[model samples]
Target: MAASLIGRHFFIQSRNRRTLTLKSRLKYSSAVQAVSNEDVESLYPPVKPRFPPGNWTSMTEEEAWTRYEAMQEMTAVPTVKERLEKLTKKQMRAYRFPVNNKSVRVLEFQKNVTKSHLIKGLPTVYDSLQVDSLILEKIKPYIIEVLLLEKERLFRSRFRDIHRDSLILRNLIQTLLPLLYEHNTALRTSQVDEEVDIKGFWDRSGFKRVMWYDPEMERPKEFRIKYANDVRFQTAHVCDVSIRTENPLKEFLPIDDELCINEEFPVLEYHPKVFGTSKTDREKSQLTPGYNLGDPCEFGLVSFHNTVWLDYQRRKYGDAVTEEMRQGMGLTASFTWLLAQAYSQGFNSLLDVTYPMTTQTVLSDGQKMSFFAYQLNTIDMLKNNMANPRQNICWYTDETQLYEKIEDGKVIGFNDETCETLLKFLLMKPERRNINMKPTLPAESSDILSETEFISRNPLDLSTETN
Candidate 1:
């Protein structure tokens, strides 16, 4: 064993010496020297094979195929799970908009071609309607009647719960009003600064009719579908343009002229049971203070409980649901559509000039209230105008509950989240630069049946279809 070990050590030493001698000889040899290919190949070669194997001459076809197969397995793309993990990690590190309140959640954030976050909600009602908007002219009176009846019912009910903790009403003043105004930056910031004359509007009996379509002689055929079998094609619609007018006398009742505290809006002597006690006498005129361009001629509190909201929550979170907990689920469609139409067609007339066409709807039922505001911006929906049908709005909406803390008949802890949200809504003014509304032909132009023209053209026809 000792002899064998000595022999192995001597062999290693001899190999090292030979390697050193070979390296020195290769380094010092003349470039012109003709060394045999076999001898040259014996020098220290590559530590490992090349990545793509060899040139065509060095690698056989079978060997190349084998290498390709091995590489295919090793360098395969990531699986779905692996990719998702990587994406999740990257997203977690990215900055996100801080949402302090758990109750308020942003469900969607859509961007348009300009990459602006002016997301318009779905137009559900508009798509379903086949008849021309002129139908609104006929049903205007009926709609007013129904709404007034509903309002009277709500007021007569005089539920104590609604007045004290009215979520719907609170949402209107705080959320909706600001949202609508801010959407059109001009109105939101009072940039136009146009002095509006309300004397005429106040003098009138408060019954006014505004035409949605222009009075033209030529009519365009806009029949959606004239099939006899489909009754859905003949349906007309009533928009939310007709809202209730305000009567200070009915609203601020119990406090007559003698007992009225505020001369401007007539404040009640004592807080009414139905409308609740005002935190201060200042509240009468303090609702939506900055909207000076147009007066709220059609302002009225409404009570509408949304059952759809309750059902949705019940399914989503298995939470306690109530009928009063109404959600304005599908109303967004009408709100967006009407506002777009108004801005595109009522720019000068229906906006704030002739009469304050601005309308406000506040619905409260459950523990919350939602608000919607409509203001006309531009009325150039005709062929010769820059009428935009997309994202051209100056409206506001909110669902945050109003009072945060109440103690001893006074709100002690006001909700910071709610207040902040309202402030944020106010801060968002509509910018003309951001308005990407393109010129689209008016939907009403499809029919040239103005009230006057339709009547003159078919004087003998007294049927509902003719006129």
Candidate 2:
């Protein structure tokens, strides 16, 4: 019986060993499968390259095509030469001259008067007063007609359709004609004062003093004298006239009239000496010895002429005056000219014409020195005259183009074409730039502090301590 028990125990041990071997093999196979799977995953990674190099990745295909179309549209518009041709053709078709006329003599006389000024040396020989009178007489009807027609058209057109060129021309004519009339009238009434010391009066005032005998008075009893405080006064008379008032015995003459005699009032002048002096003081003060003799209105006109020349450069060569140009001219001179031009042109709003994301410096001084970059907004009056008027054009800031430049949380430079396109888009309407999303964080979420945090920090005992 003992032998039989031993045999059974041996059999049980053998079976147990076989089972252990099978279990060990299964464990080894499972581990090998896991490691093989891991190796396969490492060979083929999930991450991919965002985009190919040197191509715009942010814009979708549709968006890119849209931008390209806009660029083409801007370039496809008629050139200046084509526009000029069309305009000339239109004008020729619109107007017709009468073939038969008794008015030939009148036309001849008008032509002679207009041509007289163009003849060499004739302008210098003929009294400016006579020349101006003749010019005015010949053009008066034409001027009146143009003004009336323009006014009627302006009234008919919507405010947005108003053209800047027409507005500028109108302003120039309106400001100039009245002064010319006044000057001519003054010239007509003027008389040579044989007895009076004209030289002495002029020496005292630093200007030529002219005496005009009143037309109504007999024997030149009542006289009108006009003088200037400075030699530089050109269009502006600054007339300090000693008029024959009703009361002759009144010793000190009553201040006659403070008239801005220039056709263009507030004419820009370069007077380095007058820089520090107040306008009131400059008008009141007499020219003295050792004073700096600065450039007058003539100089201002010359400067304007130079600016016009520069404009021609821009139109013809596309060589516009940049920030570098401003630097070449002294800062003061550049800014002064800029302000004068802007004011003269009646630009109510100026675009800061700097690169995108650039900041401008504004002096704290009350002299209104503020540097801003913007695109010019232009209104077209001629288009307004047409059946369908184009909308007002304004400058817009391009956020999408700018966004592409933003790196490391800051914007760098902008593409010129893109900037120009955006500006043109803005010029079409009066609306502010549409962001389509909030630029700044909302008020509620901006600050980190919360009511729950404050309440949780309060001092309160939850359980009593054992004594």
TM-score of each: 0.24, 0.14
- Candidate 1 structure quality by residue, lDDT tens digits, 1-467: 54456457768988999999988888886765765676556567667544343332333455445546543542242332222232223211111111110122221210111111121321222224243234324433332333233333445423444232233333233323443442333333232111111110000011122213332312233322222100000001212122222221011112122221222221123212122211222111111111221233222212122322344455665543221122222232223233222222222111212111233333333224354443322221111111222122223344545444333334444344433333332333222222212112233332122223423654585557654
**RMSD, every candidate, angstroms:** 29.2, 38.6
After superposition, candidate 1 runs with Cα above 4 Å error: 1-158, 161-327, 333-399, 433-467
lDDT of each: 0.28, 0.24
lDDT of 2 by residue, 1-467 (tens): 54456457768988999999998889877465543454454666666444322233334454345445533443343332222222223211111111111121222221111111111111111122123344445544443344344433446322322242234233433433353444333222222111111110011111232333334422223332333222221011111111111111110111121120112212123331222211122222121111111101101110100112222334544533322222221122212222222222222111111111101111111101112222111211111112111111111121223113333433345333332222221111111223311122222322122223545666787888889
Error of 1 at 233 (Å): 10
Candidate 1 has an lDDT of 0.28
Candidate that scores best on TM-score: 1
